[model samples]
Target: MSEDLIDEDEGPKKRVLSNSQVLGFVMRLWLRRPVLLAAAVGLMLVAIGFDLALPHAARMLVDAVTAGPANADAAWAAWALFVGVYLAFTVIRNIAFRFWNPLASRNMKELTDEAFKKVQSFSADWHADNFAGATVRKLTRAMWGYDQVSDAVVLWLGPAFLVLFGLSVMMILRWPAVGLFSLLAVTAYVATTLLMNKYYTRPANLKSVALDSRIGGALADAVSSNPTVRAFGAEAREEARIAEVSDAWRAAALKTWTRFMDVGLIQNVLLVILQAGLTGLLLRQWQAGRASPGDVAFAITSFMLMSGYLRNVGENIRMLQRGLDDVEDVANFARQAPQVRDVAGARPFAGELGEIVFDKVTFRYKSADEPIYQDFSLRIRPGERVALVGPTGAGKSTFVKLIQRLYDVQGGRILIDAQDIAHVDQGSLRRAIAVVPQDPALFHRTIAENIGYARPEATLAEIELAARRARAHEFIARLPRGYETLVGERGVKLSGGERQRVAIARAFLADAPILVLDEATSSLDVETERQVQAAMEELMVGRTTIVIAHRLSTIRSADRILVFDDGRIVEEGRHAELVGRGGAYARLHAVTQGAAE
Candidate 1:
């Protein structure tokens, strides 16, 4: 797998959380449903009490049988008690799970929802550096990992250790030596498992989990760009690349599994020592007449109880460790606050005037060596139409980004309608600005849903009006499903120009005070481009509009044309005035004109 896709040192993983923090994250969710948690814990205690009683009941039954023929009634009574205790334990344990299962499932549901919402809230730069496929893998894996951890904590960890300790104490009260051995043996077994899982198997498991995320990311990257691969006939290349990642995953996973198996050998050896030593100690007591046959029976039964719980404890330790490792990334995500966040007591974006101002704004991308804008000041009055012209990476797109508050400036501030954008609710601020990108992205939903996304409350009649205005209603009406048609992932089912028109319709529905178009007609054919162009002119009316264009002719009629070079405005004028001056805009126009001819 590519290091860029899943490297923990980069992007979101820069704030890696420890295992304990992950455990706490899971605990907080469990703590939310206190009633169910209490019920589960109480039932577990009841089940353990019944389990401990079984061995004592076995002693009474054995003694009753060995007493005499007259003791038959006594034997029958003890036998019934034994079976009843066993039955109660089985039923109670299952009932406890009934409580536990729902508690776990609900937490899983909330965890996934919270994780997705956080991912959505991340800054654009964060999303740019992370992989969608990898993020999905972590979120889904964390859910199951959470379930595993909760299961061990409620079912195995709580009951296994408690039952083992009770059995040990019970044995020690009768024969101090035998009880002491049982206690030490089980303690040593649990301790060894924890140490081995923590120090040995954990590292390997973490590597395997990371590789798993990478495989998901690699597959998503390839499949999402499958059309491009087909066009270039690179299916074989993609196959080989995926195979390389799969092979790495296989190696890491195999190593981790074998380490677990290796650790199991130690647990089996410890159980054997406990079994042999306990039975041997009982035989010594019997030979000295200090222990009866019933005592022997009790000792054997206690060892059996110890054996089962000891095994579960070892497995539970490994499971808990692995679960925590899988959950680490998501817990970190929760702890690492979003880079772009609303201020405390932030108000909604104010005013409908569509006035934008950049006051001495100094900004740079985290990954860039130099600032994009330094002490930059600009103002666009309400209802002004401004065109930005610049080469790639000359800060044209960033100008619009700053207006939308996608990234905050390191120095100074941006204001929308006299309100500092950083001091406003991001949702309200964005709702007042509509953006149409050069390459528009749409959901795999009905065309109506996609257009209505900008304004969820829009009625079908309103959607149709917007689509017709954007010249999209005619093509959409011809589809078999009309407005209800599903536009595949990212609108792949529609042509490029059709997708752009749908995007335009969405923007039209937004009805925001400020409009931004990033080469909106870049995808359309000449005829449709002209139609949408005229429609866009109408859409620009009464709105503060900023257009970024490479085709100089498209913005020739802009109220003001600002030619950006590096981070400064090198030329500011209308098309004729700028062309006559022969500056940066003039050279671009000359180049464009030569290419067209």
Candidate 2:
């Protein structure tokens, strides 16, 4: 396992990325096409500039109207020019928005795709530690949140700053009182939002985490425990459990909603106070002959514009907080170091796989305190059919996993063809081996597709040939759609025996030099097991076969049998020799024979 797989002792500290860091990461990917980003920013600036100029033009018109008849024509012409500039700004902004929005969407899609690939590349151990639904939610939420941030920066924030700055300049020019009022309103809005965020942000994040946990737990439970639920006729019980979780999620959502509503109320009250103060100041100025009706009208218009911008700023702040939380959640997964990463410059395995040697191998799952195997060693030569016989929890299955490199050993080296498997490219090593797990996991795809998954480019004839070799073609041909029949989720549509056959067919098609079968015929009836055993024997003829069997009859013809007890190999020999010796293997064989009788 890599060093990063172990959890740190710092406790959860709201693993957040700063706005600048987020922007930098986005730009690193987006700025590769500088022309697009530059054009988008340029058009936004032009739009803001034109939007800012309108308020000033309104103020100029007010001044001109108050000055006398000589300024009437100039005021009307100024209004017309303002209208023209505003329209041009709208057009340019729309054009720029059209170009930038799609690019941002595309960038988000690429990021999502890359994150998904990284998740798929993660070792099985990582999957065991994390929930699948939560990982998916994180990826989706991050992509969406990144898009919102982009929109806020380019569209919402840009326009808001333009309006605020313009109002400040105009207030200074014609009505200083209104300018101060607008600034105070902005300050109040910012303060209120910041305060609300301080109280609500953590809860909101906790709510999201709780909701994700509920979802992941429910999904995993429903799928994995369907058999138990059905057998016990507990559908209503399961539904009630789901409803309970759903209610909790809804209550959490309401808590967040209530906080948001409070923020909105506070903002509305602040806006009313600021507007009333500005209006009173304007009236006093008008009474003193310091301002005109037109000046009051301009101030009111600027306040309306600024008020709308300020409201959006408030909304964006809330979204920005949530976005950061989402991004952090997703980045956590993307940034996770794999537990079983290959060494630098790993090489591919070349030449025939001669012998697999386990040199004092030891392993333990991440959650376990004690190792499964301690100072254990085993060696099997090429073309050896070795049956590993052991009681439950004797580490037989773990041995198979170690050989496949699904998990790295904690101590000692595993050698394949006299070279350390750790030094081999993971892909090449996996390609050289095939495993038929005790519980075969099939995809939700067609029969042919599932078998062909091992070699996607295999011809239909090749698939049929492999199926025949695995004793699956006969049953497949009888299905309604034959090779095209969909297996449904986890091959639920097929019998356990049939699913095992499909798994065997996949292994047959893969044609790896090293094959591992973990109770491959355990699910089959006697007649079916006989047929599958024949096919398996033929397939194992020229390969290194590691068979884990509870039924000693299936492994009776093996060249060697290793009896395991408490993670150690207690006995090793052919079935006849072991039986003659009357050791662990003989006792195990007797127990199995008695059970069968």
Candidate 3:
């Protein structure tokens, strides 16, 4: 939601992934069901062989008819056998397709799921440096490309290869010169396809996809912050920017397709030349009585089939390149190493020691020029109530985040109950601490569901109790659907105060040993804040609590007040002591009092 989180500057262009990497990505999915893949391949090969043999059957029927009217029975029998073979392989081909499609579909689902999980696992730095829209678009396109490439390899290109091989063999058996010519034409088509794809389609398609992602990111960035855009009257500018990018995308697409068209034209011309030459040669041979009528028919069928096959080869190669281009974006994103990961042999945190110690910690945000905290050490005793009073960007939120292991410290250790967090399982470490941020985001779900999010297994009665404690139950009960009312995206259907109450209820439901109140009541009205304050007071009875607040009035009862300035604890004492001392905390508190008056 922060402007800093939207990375607008386009970095260096992404290089297309190697064909081998793309193939490896595709092939790895087959490893999941090797038997199915093998069966499919075997069946496909047999089917392709039978399909190619149909042309030979035609040749055989022509030869049988040309032999004499006495061989009519033989011709009819041959035709019947050909029909039976065709029907058999059609059944086999359908079965092979049935098995292969599921494998491809399942593979695609797994890949997309893995990428989504990986994105969620990524550190704050990775997210902050990437655009959410661009990342999502890349993942979507990558998944689609994965599906296309898988289908092309297993369904299109795979069969094409077998068909071509079988056709070549059949041609050679009929005429050695024709077989060699067909093979040469195929070889040339493939070479041209590879060269053209490498130099033209790959780069062009990559540019096109890149532009599309940028447009997607830009559109999302503009639309998500609709309130800001509308308030600032920047709608026209946003639309113009989108149009510019979209036009560029169109141009890029056209360039790639135009190159494909050129390649197609070249292929068509080459095929025509090959066809003409082969047909003329066959006719001359037939005139000299060196070739039979069957040979002529076979030559025509083979050339027609080879022409289409060669065209498809070009198309498949382009598809492979396009797939590689699309996946390259997501692969780059997934390759980002998570900054915080569970250490080897790490154990889940247990118990409620409720003690947190920052031992000579050093930390800085990725985008910041200087460390927010360096050689900073602090200790909060079990059930201690500490208030962190600081100006914006004084490292208050960062401290809480580090304690929860949302981001690890750059140097030194953050220990919970004397156990180093970095050495413990992240999930367990977070489980011990519950955070209620200033702007708590809620999913679009029922009020009860949102409140029970932290403890998914909590019963309705338990949820209602937590809501009552947070002063949220009465309002929820008043809604038409009561607790079942749908909170629209980010809980926008609810007022700020209601959303805050739901967040408080969620925290109450969590009941963790340590609590972080990051200006939790900042959005509530004075009356609601008072009620929530009472609830928080009750919840804090036996928990180690860290309260980050700018409003000094809220922390009057805190046992100790820490005044942070420039990442250092400039002043620390009880609220009354700091007020009497007339130091940093006293000055900050005075500003709040003055502003209130």
Candidate 4:
């Protein structure tokens, strides 16, 4: 598997976000849990208040001491009050954080789960066009990113306001020069943090995108080429490819981290400058007799408070950048439009499906520009057994896809029971039809569970009966675990014939009015194919059956045979009549028979 499939190269692009827009997006999810948000906000405010009060308590202790040597009792009383108040605030802050962290984590988990559920509801075409690994990365990032928003709100914004409020109080009560110097230090710290962040944000975001692409590409390629890798004995080669991609990812990550550490270094330097300047100013004021020893102590306390708050502010800025990157990935996923969407006011289909009509229908794969089928038309009557026989790109699969409404026709309409399929709800349409593809895929589950997937609530007896009808029960019973035998991933534990039999059992269990077998029995040997074909004949007794097959012998008994060339049906009739006509069907039948000989 090529690494590019999972993680393609995407260049750095500036994300567009006004402050109001970003805030609005964040608030939308938070507001959904009003009580939790309110509680978090209240706790944050309480924490901030306690933090701000600590600096005031220190100032009070200083003022009491400065009243003169005879005021020793008052100083002792002030010291005791300050210690008690500070301890109470510390306890309160810890308690608030305990309440806040859990609420934030829970909300984030719920929001991500909701997004995943929405993704699952999309149709097959959506999955085909989008990489599964990329989607997983987006969901994971979204959940973890919400925590960054919480940190910014509670740790950064809250502490910043508290520090500013504390500084204001000190300026009023203490020496003016000391207070002025303390404010200047705060300004310098904020300025340096912001400037560093501006340089770091873009690179960090690009690194995230690159990492997502690398992981996604590796996973996609590994899964898509599992058979080839195993067959060619290229496991070592695949491992080397994965290692190369991992190395590229590590390089990108290190670049981002280095930039982030540089920002941290700059922040620390500014903090040192601020603390030293404040300390020097306070000592000068005390020497000049403009401030007492206790007043100088208060100035030191104020500097510590400012430093703690500014450090938190810097941390929050870093967190905010990470949160933005995560949200961008989520936004990219959420903004994806489903390749096929239901029409407005689409209603559920009711009653039996009659003639299915395709009028000038057209379609093409996502990577293809030209339509695979152009101006294609077909009318299949109720209970008609139609075999669509064609060469590999002759639009046989595309025709079946249109009938199931997996992808809407690009040029015209497909009608079921005289009503446009697009107007009916997809669930209802699919419920009336059953499909068994060429290579049947089974989930990693028990034999009974695989058969019961078409009808999850099917009883054990019902499953057994369906299996018997599909000639699969005899083989299933012989297994060590009987019906409970695990099928392994994609039914790799079973032979090709057994897997097709299981798929046939599923179709029998579905009991839908329309049955589609797209090379459904291609895997079976001659003897097994005969038995499975017999079972299919019985199951198709009262259903509209559409079979796509290359083997003419399997489809020879179909009520109507539609022979396709390129993207158009060149001939249509019964087996004997078509063979007698010496047209496309007859010529293909001759070729197949010759190959068999």
TM-score of 4: 0.89
Who wins the lDDT comparison? 1
Poorly placed runs, candidate 4 (over 4 Å): 1-7, 10-24, 62-80, 94-102, 121-126, 155-158, 161-184, 223-227, 364-367
Q: Give the whole-model CA lDDT for all candidates, comma-separated.
A: 0.89, 0.79, 0.81, 0.77
TM-score of each: 0.97, 0.91, 0.94, 0.89
lDDT of 1 by residue, 1-597 (tens): 111233452245454466677888999999999999999999999999999998889989999999987999999999999999999999998998899888988999999999999999999988888889988999999998998898877788888888888888877888888889988998899889988887889878988988898898899999999999999999999999999999999999999999999999999999999999999999999999998888889888988888888888888888888888778778878987898999899988877889999999999999899999999999999999999998999899999988888898999989889999999999999999989888889999999999999999999999999999888999999999999999998999998888888988998999999999899887678987987787788788889999999999899889999989889888999999999999899999999999879
Q: Where is model 3 poorest over a 10-residue stretch in terms of lDDT?
A: 1-10
Candidate 4 lDDT (Cα, whole model)? 0.77
How many backbone overlaps does candidate 2 show?
A: 0
Best candidate, TM-score: 1
Give the lDDT of residue 259 in candidate 4. Answer: 83
lDDT (tens digit, per residue) of candidate 2 on 1-597: 011232211122234444456555655657766778888888888888887776656767777777788888988887787688779889989988877877887888887998887787778866765666656767887798777777776678767877786777668676676677777777777777767775665456556555755566576667667988999999899888778777877877777777877888888888788778777788889899997777677667667777788888878877766665566555555556776778999999763654789999988887788998998888899989999998998888888889889999989999988889999888888878888877898999999999999999999999999999999999999998999999988898998888988988999999888998899888788887888778788778789999999999989889899998888899999999999999898899899999999
Q: Ranking under TM-score, best-scoring first?
A: 1, 3, 2, 4
lDDT of 4 by residue, 305-406 (tens): 777777778788778767755665555445556557778999997648557898888777766878888888889999999999989888888787787788
Give the lDDT ranking, best first: 1, 3, 2, 4
